[model samples]
Target: MRTVFIFMNEASQAVEIPKDMQFEAVAELEIRREGDTVLLRPVRPNWVSFAHEPTASADFLAERPCVLKTDYFDLSGAGESSEEPGQ
Candidate 1:
């Protein structure tokens, strides 16, 4: 394990992370304190990564007709209700 020093200014504090311990430019992280230890965890985005080829055709949706189904949820409301305990 490596140890780094934290610097403080008049308003805020900063920690100069080494290049090897740095995250991506667009990466998001969450800092939490558990007892006396501080943890840095990455917050993953709700998205999927895909690549597009210039030579490939855009007939993916046309080949699959079942992708246009609109019956994804139950409109009958037969599940558990979301009422509060006191209500």
Candidate 2:
């Protein structure tokens, strides 16, 4: 509902988001357009990107055995149900 300015940055278009609306400590934003509306979203970090990085921290990449504080559900029989051979 807030009004924002849309201007050109060299060749591509850019929007100047207000400081109050800006995402804290974020260097990038994920932009997507649907129909006539343009959406701006904060780019949250995921483990896949970290795992693929060449210089991740040793503690993060280390094979440290972890103890589960709470019980975890067993997935041993997850997909053993009867199905077609090619399925």
Candidate 3:
């Protein structure tokens, strides 16, 4: 079986790859979504989870506003953060 890791967002997958394209060596896929459409790309599967972190400092945050999310999350209700309903 081919192991595929996908980042879930807004009750949909952020990344999806065809079964045929998923080879033994290929474990990870990258995707960026606009509404319901998904654009698939190649990535390092092993480090997908590792990439989910706040890379900006306080100065950076002041310059640009952004929201951070974690890997391996639920979208139907509360997200990975066990705090609120929409967060």
Candidate 4:
């Protein structure tokens, strides 16, 4: 909706940013060229995606109970003691 002129390798050229655009004093942006058009977009921080509250309930841990006992088998000596019929 806004138009801005960007000059390449021109130090004297000045670009005016719209006042409605809100940003911090210092910000990072990404520029890309698609065909003949150029696109500019803000580079968000990595943590921004995880900034919101989780959709799952907070009592999720309490719903799943832990089992104290587990079953395991020992197969180390099973095949070692068995011999071939020809032997």
Give the number of the best model, judged by lDDT: 2
Q: Please report, in order, the local distance difference test score of every candidate based on alpha carbons.
A: 0.73, 0.82, 0.64, 0.68
- For model 1, what is the alpha-carbon lDDT of residue 36? 100
State candidate 2's TM-score: 0.55
Best by TM-score: 2
- Model 1 TM-score is 0.45
- Residue 75, model 4: Cα distance from true site in angstroms: 23
At residue 49, candidate 1 shows an lDDT of 31
TM-score of each: 0.45, 0.55, 0.24, 0.34
Clashing pairs in 2: none
CA lDDT, candidate 1, residue 32? 90
In order of TM-score, best first, we have 2, 1, 4, 3
lDDT value, candidate 2, whole model: 0.82
Model 3 off-target regions past 4 Å?
1-18, 44-87
lDDT of 4 by residue, 15-86 (tens): 566778745564777778899976667886567656764676777677666675544776667667567768
Stretches of model 2 off by over 4 angstroms after superposition: 52-87
Q: How many angstroms is residue 32 displaced in model 2 relative to the true structure, after the best TM-score fit?
A: 0.5
